[model samples]
Target: MVQDALAGAGYPQHVLVACSGGPDSLALAAVAAYFARRGHVDGRPVTVGAVIVDHQLQPGSAAVAAATARTLKDLGLAPVQVRTVEVAAAGMGPEAAAREARHTALEAAADEAGAAVILLGHTLDDQAEQVLLGLARGSGTRSLAGMRPSRGRLLRPFLGLRREDTLEICRVEGLDPWHDPSNTDPAYARSRTRVEVLPLLEEKLGPGVAESLARTAAILQLDADYLEEVANATFERLREPAGGGHARNDRTGIEQAGKGISLPEAALRDLAPAVRFRVIAKAAAAVGGQQPSYQRLLAAEALLRRHGSAGPVELPGSVSVYRLSLAQLEAEGQSAAAGVPREGARCGKLVFRPQRPSRK
Candidate 1:
């Protein structure tokens, strides 16, 4: 299955396996090395290498990383490299920080090795856990889509396999997998989800909840792909060009004038809620504004639906969205309620302006 995934992704030349000495990664390293030595994946010759990233978040991490690299070399994986990365606890917490650091290290190692793809060992169980977390957080469809088999240079070939299968592979190959203590620690949400939540779900849901969740993720992924395509097309149609240009002949009355994009109140009101909100979000992002939250999007939509209501809807990153007419843009020094102009604008344009930081 791993070999098939790599081939299907058109990454058959050189691949880097992200090994953490865990059962999943060890199995991946063994399988990948075996295929590379056999001289073909999908009838094409391949070279396999391994990278072990030590986050140094725990005691004896250097020794663990070194041991993992040695095991990879013994498994017939050439060019085994050990990279030590510093994990800073950002706002997203230690797990996310470590993940970001690990990916950075793996990408650097892959580039150094001239590898076409970086293979990860995320299994079906991990995908199920991710979907469940997304559900718990009430995140939208994109979050529930779970991990993709191929995302840019990162590939997860084992996503279709169960966690037990990797453990079995390790046992049959006589690979001593290093069990990371963090895997069982309750401090991390993923650890708690894996050790406690999944088991309880299996007990109550009658044994296949994980499989069902994985299937749900696959279906949601398809839906998300289609929706994104539609959203992108709609955004393009609704967006006013950066420079002054005639708007499309659509009834939406979108206009581009002097560095601002504008949509008529009637144009937005006629759109499906999904397409409308997506276009609004895309418009905000195109103007160097931060992606707004669901609430912010809703507020912007409400402003558009209302007639003759001038709003200075404040968004993240000090960006603000306004609903002003062409007459208002021509005026000078409008009142606070009418919104202060930060840059050039023409009437009927929904302007996204980032507030300039005050000089110290």
Candidate 2:
């Protein structure tokens, strides 16, 4: 299934499997190698490598990483690239932060190795947990989509496979994987959700509840994608640059990329309700540096449409929305969106400062 999925997606010949010596990751590495070998036997071959990231949060992490590398080499796999990265914060306070750091390391490694896709070991069980967590957040649409199969260079090939299946694979291959004690520690919310909540729900609700939740998330992702497309079209028409951001003299160019979702208040109000809502939401998202919810967007729309100079309306990411005038919706800064600014002359509110200012 893993090999078929990769081929179906037109996955690149060079593959990088993210391994951590855990059962899930170990199983993924083994499965990936199996598929690659089969391809080689069938006249088509793939170059496969494994990368193990040691967060160094534990004393034995380095040793575990080394063991993982040794295991891969013994299995006729290429030498595992072991990366020891600092977790920065101590203890279990920043689980999300640690995961982000680990992903960053994986991306950097993939880029360095020229690997087109980084395979993750996230099983169906993980997907279910993500759905449960997303539900807890009480957000709508996009929030419920959970994890994606293809996110940039990272791909979760094992997401369709069950945890039990992965464990069985490890057993068949005589792979002894270490269990992370942290996974069972009640100190973590996810651990409690897994050990306490999920089991109880499974008993009371029904068997295969986790699978149901994952399926739901998959459906939600499709809906989210469509909504984003509609939102993008609506956003393109009314966007303008925020304060201290580069301006776009080429409205046609900016519109094509959906950056102008930060349009002025006057420009936004001229649109119909559906279009207005999307424009407002996009503007807030651009200003807030976070994905603006429909509710937040509605509030922003009300504020701007009412022509209220009440005060700066706070959005995500230290961004504020202001009605500089009846026709103007001013964002605090140009960082409503992530990444570097586009190249061009300054226009509207978005400013472009060249690395070296032209002195003629």
Candidate 3:
């Protein structure tokens, strides 16, 4: 399975494993080392390396990183790096902040080594826990989809394997993996999910509940992927055509700094709610705004049906959407929103632009 994943990814010349000396990551490192040294990936010569991120959150994190690096070297992996990162408690909380910092460090390591592929060691158990957490938050379909096997430069070959499989592999390799106490620490939500909630769920709901959750995530991932594709295509199709506006559409750079994208109010009003919300979210993104919440999207939609109400439907990331009549644009000499109206057209245009700064 591990070899197949590398082959499917085209086996980039430089492959780095994000190892943390845990059983799962250690097992992954072992397989990756064998593939690089003994296996063939599209007959390409591959260099397998390891990166251990010391978050410095727990005491002795540096020591753990050093030991992990040494182990990888002994396992015949080349270019092992121990990158230390500061884990500040950002608004997303400690886990998310540490995750962000760790990824940044890994990215830096990959860049320094010119690696195009980075392997992660998340297993089916982790996927189950992630799904449960997503469920608790009443998240959208994308959130419920959980982690994918391949995300850009990151790949997880063990998503099909159970946690016990990695543990068994560690024993077979005669490797004593460092069990991070944080895994069982109740202070963390994931730890509690893994040690307590999952077991209780198993006792009450019977065995295979974790497996069921993972399967649900896999199914939802399929749905989410399809919706995103349809949404993007629909977004491009429904938006006002780019020409006829006064500005040369430099939408990619400086022009994008303030000017917003446009959608026809009539076109958006015709779409189903699911596709419409996704399209609205894409418009917000195009205007340098973050994903609007469901409520925000609803507010933006309400403006679509409202007449004679010139609204700057406010969204996050300093973005605002407006409903504009051709007359309104003509009076203000405003560039046609997104695109110019058809000659003698009656419909209004929806524009998304950056918010104006208040004067002191």
Candidate 4:
């Protein structure tokens, strides 16, 4: 079933496997290797390279990463590279910060190996946990939908399978899985969810509860996909390009500064609530300059729904959107109720003013 999905998705070809020495990832790496040897998804043969990221948070992390690389080498998989990623303990919580760093490191390794697809080991269990977590945070449909099977260059072949199944496979394959103590520690919310919450939920609700949640996520994914399609179509009618100058449209830049975006008030009023939210999201992303967090998106949508308001709303540090009667742009935080300048006329042709000169 897993191999068929990879074949259907054109994955496990020139693949970079994220192996953390845990049972889930180790099983994934081994299974991918098995399929690669058979040339199931490739004309020439598939090449599997293992990438282990050392977060360097713990004292034994570097040695563990080295050992993981050696283990993969013993299994006939060459080491593409081992990377050490640093995460600052601020702004983002520890779990979120570590995840971001790990993904960044994995992407870098995949790029270095010239790999088109990167395999992760997210299982059905993880999907259930994510759905529960999203509910806890009161997030939107996207979060409730859980992790995608294939996002960008990343692919998770085991998402439909269970973690216990992977562990069983590892035992049968004679692979010694490395257990992370963090999984059992109560210090992390995920650990608590895995050890305490999931078990209680299972006891109260009976088995297959996790599976039921996984099924919910799958259904939500289909719905999300359809909604995104609608959003793309609506975006075509609603989008108003930013005036020239400001920042270049380079998605690769960090702290994207000096970009301009605008929206048509008439156009916004025509769409339904759902379509309106989607249009705002795209415009904020495209020209307002950065990807707003889920929370910020909701806040922006709220402000828009109320008063057909004009002016700025403060978001997380250093990010704001100016909803002028005529235009909107991503800028630093300011008072949302601030009076508009008389000269800030509703000129059909709004010009972009750069906050600062480009590095050049």
- The TM-scores, one per candidate, come to 0.87, 0.79, 0.89, 0.80
Clashing pairs in 3: 260-352
Write the residue-wise lDDT of candidate 1 on 229-310 in tens digits: 8888877765654333222212323222235455544455567887788778877777667878888988887786544436
* Model 1, TM vs. native: 0.87
Candidate 4, 207-270: lDDT as tens digits: 9989998999999999888888998887775455454533432332322245555555445555
TM-score of 3: 0.89
CA lDDT of each prediction against the hidden true structure: 0.78, 0.68, 0.83, 0.70
3 or 4, which is superior by lDDT? 3
- Candidate 3 lDDT (Cα, whole model)? 0.83
Query: Model 1: residues >4 Å from true position, as ranges?
Result: 241-265, 329-347
As for lDDT, the candidate ahead, 1 or 3, is: 3
Q: What is the model-wide C-alpha lDDT for candidate 4?
A: 0.70
**Cα lDDT of model 2 by residue, 50-132, tens digit:** 89999887779989999999988766566469887877576445788679789889988888888888889998888888888
Candidate 1: 10-residue stretch with minimal lDDT: 247-256
Q: Is candidate 1 or 3 superior in TM-score?
A: 3
RMSD from true fold, candidate 2: 8.6
Higher-ranked by TM-score: 1 or 4: 1
What candidate 2 gets wrong by more than 4 Å, as runs, is: 39-43, 90-93, 241-281, 285-288, 292-299, 324-360
